[model samples]
Target: MKKITVFWGCQIPGRLTFLEKSTRLGLAALGYEINDIPEFGCCPEKSLIKNEDEKLWLLTAARNLALAEREGYPLVVACNGCSSTLKTAYVKLKGNPKLLAEVNEKLWEFGLKLGGSLKVYHLIEFLADEVGAGVIKQRVQKPLRGLKIGVHPGCHQNRPSPAASFEDPLNPRKYDILVQALGATTVEYQSKLMCCGNNLTLAGKLDDGWRMARVKIQELTNLRADALTVTCPACFMQFDQKQALYARQGDILNLPVLTYMELLALALGIEAEELNLKEHRVDPSPVLRKAGIINEPLPFNEEVLKRCLTCGACEYDCPSARTGVMSPQGIIKRFLNGEIEELINSSEIWECVECHTCLEYCPQRFGMEKVFTWLKHQAMVRETYPNSLKSGYEMFVKTGRLAKIDDRQRQKLGLPSLSSQEPRQFVEKLL
Candidate 1:
């Protein structure tokens, strides 16, 4: 079996043991031999310590890396912040002899020197690149279908390109690809790439941190996303804890925030209790139901569904309905009247562009867009979709992007090179 030193970092073991538990179980299920190092301290946390003392930060991170070197095992970090700090330190010490010597001089007190040779990997990068999403999908005993997950790839995961150049900083898709591989739809929210605001809390600006988390939770809630998935424990805490804190004030966000590993463990047939999901601030029962992990059906407000059927408010806001043959209200009405077969047989159900305009404009807050989505899923399972729809789906399933950027046109306009397309190979197999 493949082996690597698993760095649980500080937060996971201290406050987020659920994340650590799920990560260990998930990785082991994926056939990795996890070598635990109890000697490792905090990745010393870059934002807090590095800004305060650069020298101390470098020496501390270098010590951790040197230990991994002595163990003769590459490091696999579970926390994005930890990975960011370690990777940045590795690049700096390895690239600069004088800096490495200075750090090594300090480390020699503990009989350790900065080896500057061991490689480090974030857990997400390891799974996306090494374990491969294709193999992961094959191992899924319970696919998280019928659930919409909002992915929050924390800022430190793939930023500071010189240190963490494994993924595109501006448009990272590895998290989204992994979510899709679990058979859940990735919901696109406005604040998908925004900071989780844990830094603000750490900086003693508690309200500001809550405000940042609130904005994202509100957006994801509005989009009707079932859960918010994250790779970092800090981001997970920001969303999970803050959401619960706000709820105590009567402002209920109610979105279940889960670490990617926790979600993966669930899909790998690990029980919810084993993953310590109940310890989460927000209850994940609704999300579990939607994912079919629980044996209960998700409750739908019949009055709201009925109100949506009668009100054509969504149709006016739908771009596809405005340009195409069918309206959003028409699809809902047909489904309500038990014309499911006709709706499935027709191409009107597939005409939705999934722009989510109806969701935004619906006064009842529950729109027919979700109804259309369910219909589309049924159509897909029945293989009754239109040829054009099939061709587009096939193309997207084959290529991560619907269409490639015209490099020639970009060059003529003197634009910078296009972002990385590394997601194509893994995403194709995922779909």
Candidate 2:
């Protein structure tokens, strides 16, 4: 089992306990045991405190890291704000030993010294890049197949890019990848990358903050998403509680908001009733009901699909993949998007030669060959296998030949004449 530390920043432990519960439950399901630190104080709320007194912010963040450093496990954070704050401090302290000494000077009185060895990870980063979508998919007991989730990969998670080093800082996909790993579809909107303006609210710009959140909410409302998923507590509050206030005043935005951890926990088979979702001002029942039903279990190892989603190594070695007409990644991507019926119906699945060439190039040693084989099995079960394939099978059964012997080319190459008599005798005996 993998062991890690969770830095549940102030907001979650103090106000949003449900997010904590879901995160712990989900990570535990993924084979992680959290080593908690009672000494952690705060991530220091960078927006309001950092610019005013960066040293104090750095000092507090350094102290927190120092507290967790002794455990020597990678620290995972749930909120994007906390993630950015800690990472920035980590980057700053590591780059400037003088600053580290100054922070350590202040921390010595508290009997704490910042060693700066602890690796920090935002939860989405840990899930996608570390634990991997493959392991998450392997643990999924119920996939959120039918519900369309609107992902709010809040800005702080990747902004100030040098510090975070997350996947695709500008156009992030790790959140979408985490969501899709649970078997739900993610929708695109115009303001997908917009800031939630929580910092504006904290900076005494409540009206401006609400307006920014309102526009994104309205866009998603127009898009008719089943629910919104966020990676930040601030964004969650902006959409959930703030929107709740609007409902009381008769605005009634009617969109349920959830954090990525909560969705992951639910997908990992934790009951919705146990998650304390009642704390949300907006109701999550509609989404829960839509996604609550467990679909028929996957027939193959789901880890294969998860690992296959990111790999195209096989495409380089396969003749069919080189044609560019039927790429393996395309088929797996569509399959991950819950488009299996559409894919199984298309002629694309039949195009493979079952040559096992892809197995040679695949990094995981399992290749698109398994996917093609699975599709073939489904095709046979559904009577969708093409007539040409059926004729080939029948030809093999009756005469031990799929087609007439093409010995002319063989003769031209100075090969020997083809002999079918021995094969026919062998086929008769097998029958």
Q: Of the candidates shown, which would achieve the greatest TM-score relative to the real structure? A: 1
Query: 421 in model 1: Cα distance from truth in Å?
Result: 45
lDDT of each: 0.83, 0.83
lDDT of candidate 1 at residue 402, scale 0 to 100: 75
User: Per-residue CA lDDT of candidate 1, range 247-343, in tens?
Assistant: 9999887999988998999999998889878889999987886565754322356567788877777666788767766777767767677676567
- Over 4 Å off, model 1: 297-431
RMSD of 1: 14.6
lDDT of 1: 0.83
Summed backbone clashes in each candidate are 0, 0
